[model samples]
Target chain A: MLVTKWVHVPEKAINKPRQIEQDGVKFTQSISPWDLPQQFRFLIDAESLTIEWRYLSDSEPVKRKEFPDGFAVELGKTSSRIYKITVSLSALEKSISVMPTDEAEAATSALIKMKNALAEIENYPNENNKVAMTKTAHWWANLPNKAELLANAM
Target chain B: MLRTSLAVYGWLNWVARGYQRASSYIASSCGFFLLIDTEKSEFLSTRPVITKFVQEIQSNMFILFCLFLFLAVIAHILTKKTSLDVWKEIKFILDRYQEKCFPNNKEKDLHRVTLFRLEKHCLFRRHWSSRNWLNFRGHCRLFSNFLVPVLRSGHINGKSNTFFQVGSDQNYEGVAGLAFRQKSQVAVKNLPDLSSPLMAKVKDRKRLITEYALQTNCKRELIEKWVELGKTVPRSIAATPVEVNGQIWGVLVLDSTSPETLSSESVSDYTVVIAVIGKLLERM
Candidate 1:
């Protein structure tokens, strides 16, 4: 099952808790990847066991990476135009990522997501990883140019 | 006297008709009154009285008509004089503003002559406001999404004030936002009271709206966070969208503490000022 939701974060509320509702479930956390205001679309894939977030302005994924049996989280401060966060899902209960002082809260929230996703995967591991990967690849290939379509509509 | 004379003359005419008939009968029977010529006598006697009465009425009517015409001309002149005086003053200020701000047609740097400085030089606040308490605020259109306030001028309690932050931006919200969205001038003679129960009901129980809730459409919670914002919500607001090169570039907003300060009649004057501003911006 694949579900998508849009999240709009208003400007200048750095310390406020953000609530995200996916499908029928709700996730309450203080997860602010970027300090700047932006709108994002979350693609939640249960079969591939991946959560891909894309920026609305330029339909680009933040980042994507694979981890070993333990979930891997990477955090860095880069001078890129857009901020990026890479998280890998596995059965690991711990995260190995340095948290910057200014973004410690956001980093912690990212780690919490990693642990929660890892726990879920452990409980229900994909029976056929090959099939899931093939489906995910096909889904990515068939993705539309949403940003361009939105601009044209406007 | 005229009425009495008219009554007496009418009675005499009636008697003359009867007398003339009797005289004709007598002249035909006895030939004694034939030399009298009753027909001629009757007409000659009544002609002068009728002509004098007509002249008197005509003279009185002519005098009344002339008097009314004279008063109408005087009233028209007085009205024009007052409006012409205001128009002359407005033109003088606008001319002075252009001369002072852009002397010798020298274009100043945009950064050097900021919107605040432009507003100060414009002198519209002093000219438009009867009480000289009008505030002039300027906003620049940003990316077609936001109206960022570049300059805001006003006082609080008869002292210099710094309330709204300089770079705060708004979307389609206030009278200025309405003007920006509509790409035209918008004037509100009196703003509704947002704190009133009627407004709260209209807002669907959103009672926490800001003091600028009605005037500026700013939220109360946001105002609290900003702290110094919207200490004095204006009672009246007038906004004109400034166009540069046929495209809306920004908005010029004027507000006053008293109701009806900035009215629809003032929108034309503001439009003239905004035209000059647009040209100045183009030069810059």
Candidate 2:
């Protein structure tokens, strides 16, 4: 069975697996092509008709679409499975379709793993922790009830 | 336009006569005409001559002019409306034929629904059928009640040959096949190839020649060379590319049941249809 995930990232960033360490929490981000197997990783920009697909262990991306604009990609009976940590900074939508022959217990275990990973990451603080603090301090300086908060705390 | 408008007006007037009054009026008029016009008219000549000679009161000329106008009005009205009625009947029959050919379409209603996404798509629908398909071009119509489907599916064979089916009929069992090449990608649809195991294969010399000619994009030299070969050996021909919007999409291959089966005019019409289809596919 193949699963599917569509992730939208900043245009400046290349989509790939990455590890980040912040606030005593470890997070990993990754994506697989929606079509074909995981072994065949393709980055398709359909408007320019440019396709870059490569097999595992191959350093060079094979260009296929060739045209300057993008075209629609036909998966031709293949699906994708993706794993990533749930974070506020990035957007992700994932879907999974299991094969008819897949064992129920195996599918459940994979779902559990995904759920645990999401729960762990959701509890972690945002990467830009200083921005929150600076905004709060700036707002407090202009507040009419500023004395009240200090009085209640004291 | 005037004739058409008048015909429509007359029909409206006839229908609005409330059935009761129109029937009685028609019956009474017929009875009066029958009584007066039945006898051999020896008195009619003298009556008309006397009426004609009267200087200030020429009733015969006035009556004759009125009768002429009435006949003209009636003839014009009946002809235009009758043709429209016949055309409506034809459209209904064609729609039914399309429904039967492509039955029970749920999601897209593609067979019936019009897709106005692209100007090219609209142009394709406007020009995609041969004049032979229509039944009323001076009575030279073929397939009076047949629904022709557009080419939407195709297959590329192992030998790099393409076969396609077009027109509403999916099972175009033994029809002329058109083969074209698109950047080395062969797409065959709209017709079944005779050489394929799936269809009825017959040895037709003229058709093969035409197929070769079309594959070569109707080049006169290539066609003449093949014709001079004495029709004994089948020759392999290369397709010349057709350019649209500054790009050479592919070469169009056309074939019919027989070589001279379609006239030059028919071929021209078919070419226009193919060009329209190509533009539609390009947009998609």
**Chain B TM-scores across candidates:** 0.38, 0.23
Cα TM-score of candidate 1: 0.27
The 0-to-1 C-alpha lDDT of every candidate, in the order given, reads: 0.38, 0.28
Q: Write the per-residue lDDT of candidate 1 for residues A32-109, one digit (tens) a residue.
A: 122122443322222122233232122222333345543343211221112233333223222323222212222233
Candidate 2 regions with alpha-carbon error over 4 angstroms: A1-154, B1-86, B106-109, B113-284
DockQ agreement of candidate 1 with the native complex: 0.01
Candidate 1 per-residue C-alpha lDDT over B1-284 given as tens digits, one digit per residue, 9 for 90 to 100:
22244345556555555554454453354333224343356653668766565445444655645764565454444434342343234334444443443344332221011121112122222211123243333332222234444433211122222222212253344555565544444556455444345643635434434334544544345433333343444556656665544345566655554555455444443333555555555544
Q: lDDT per residue, candidate 2, A1-154, as tens digits? A: 1222221122112222334332222222221111111221112121111112221112212222111111222211111112111111111122222322121222222223333442444432221112222222233334454334323322
Give me the TM-scores for chain A across all models, comma-separated. 0.29, 0.18
Fnat of candidate 2 is 0.00
**Candidate 2 chain A lDDT trough over 10 residues, lowest sum:** A83-92
> After superposing candidate 1, which stretches have Cα over 4 Å from the reference?
A1-154, B1-144, B152-171, B192-215, B223-230
